[model samples]
Target: MGWLDGYVALVTGGASGIGRAVVKRFIAEGCTGVGVMVRSAEQAQGLQDEFGDKVLTLMGDVRSPADNQAAVEATVARFGKLDTLVGNAGVWDFFAKLEKMPIEKVAESFDEIFGVNVKGYVLAAHAAAPNLRASGGSMIFTLSNSAFYAGGGGPLYVASKHAGVGLIKQLAYEFAPEVRVNGVAPGGTVTPLRGPVSLGKQGKSLSAIPGFEENVANVTPLRFIAQPEDHAGHYVLLASKENSCATTAAIIQSDGGWEIRPLR
Candidate 1:
């Protein structure tokens, strides 16, 4: 029996990067079904090709309330109950400094970055709350070391992730004693995390940055960059009642010891 035996889950941004890894891992852990919210038909087709009926891929934008709700309803409908909600969709600001942008650009970038990273999570939580409460399930969000430290991204991206910390705390409080809410903060991982369109970086991916992996490895205390799979287990643990019971409003830092970075 796997950790998530017979479980059902809904994951946003489940097409690629850390989000995709979580969907794959959840199924490997014996999830009965995983509802994936993706933005493109290609993503939906790719998931179907890989996981087949094990996953139900829904094409939609994470910033949409109806899409989030549809994903939740679809998961419970297919698997009979919802056990986990993984709010993993997000956008980065590519380290776009605040002072460099005009005030108007800043506003647009903030909306785009926060729309995907912050508001998306909020909508997913709202949609999944009832189901999670009914099944005594948990909510796991994909945060970043940026949520705490700096230099992970630009002002918009970093600030958006920081907002997630508070979101988790508030939601955990609202759903206490019945459902748990938590987060996984990953360091520089080699995934195709996208940038905000507001900055004309929508076509660019995080991993495509020149020497990104090497740079991340050199700076990180662990001397290595992470892969999406490295953080997937944290989500599994948070989703498992046996492992993380009584744990709520907590964030597990999986960023290669980010708290002790800079090598003193």
Candidate 2:
């Protein structure tokens, strides 16, 4: 039997990037059912084409509590139970340095960033709580190195990540032995969450970070940036009953070697 032979999982932002990778990983590990809550109909169709009915695509905004509730309800209705909820939808904000950033930018960016990252997680957990309690399942949020360190994201994004770290602990306490809550912090993975794309013409030049890719590659003890698939295994491991029964409120840092680089 596969590690997740009878598991049913829901992945927010599941049509692309790390979320897509997680969905693929779960299916590969023998998860019996997987649902991907996407933000676009075209992306949802693409996932449906790829996985047929084994993957359910719900197009909804994570910012909406109603949408989150409906997605959770749809998953349980389709699969009979919900074993895992991957809160992987988030946004990045760049243009706003704390001092020079506009008040509107701060408000808009914080609202947008926290809307999906923080509120979405809370709503998803609230919606999935009873089902997870029934199955003694887990919830995993895709966080970033930004949660622990600065510079990956600007002021607003960094603050949002820090809040996510707190959410893991808070939810873990709330869910307890019945349902586990945790996060994965991956450093320099090539996720679609490129810095501040929404900032348009005013966004920071990601390429200007001084040999950003090569420097990141060199700094990591692993000696390379990771692909989304590289980070997916941890999700499977955490969701596995045998491997993770004793692990909860844990933040698995899949950050290559960002935490231990030599002083430069």
Please give, for residues 111-229, the per-residue lDDT of candidate 2 as tens digits: 77777778988898898899999999999999988899877767787888889899999999988979989899888766556453334522444434557678668778889978889
Cα displacement (angstroms), candidate 2, residue 187, comes to 0.8
**Highest lDDT scorer:** 1
Model 1 scores what on Cα lDDT? Answer: 0.92
Model 2 regions lying over 4 Å from their true place: 194-198, 201-212
TM-score of each: 0.98, 0.92
- Give me the runs in candidate 1 sitting further than 4 Å from their true place: none
Where's the lowest-lDDT run of ten residues in candidate 2?
Answer: 196-205
TM-score of decoy 2:
0.92
Q: What is the lDDT of residue 162 in candidate 1?
A: 94
- lDDT (tens digit, per residue) of candidate 1 on 1-264: 899998899999999999999999999999999999999999999999999999999887889999888888888888899999999998888899999999999999998889899999999999999989999999999999999998899878888999999999999999999999999999999989888889999999999999999999988889999999999999999999988997999999999988887655
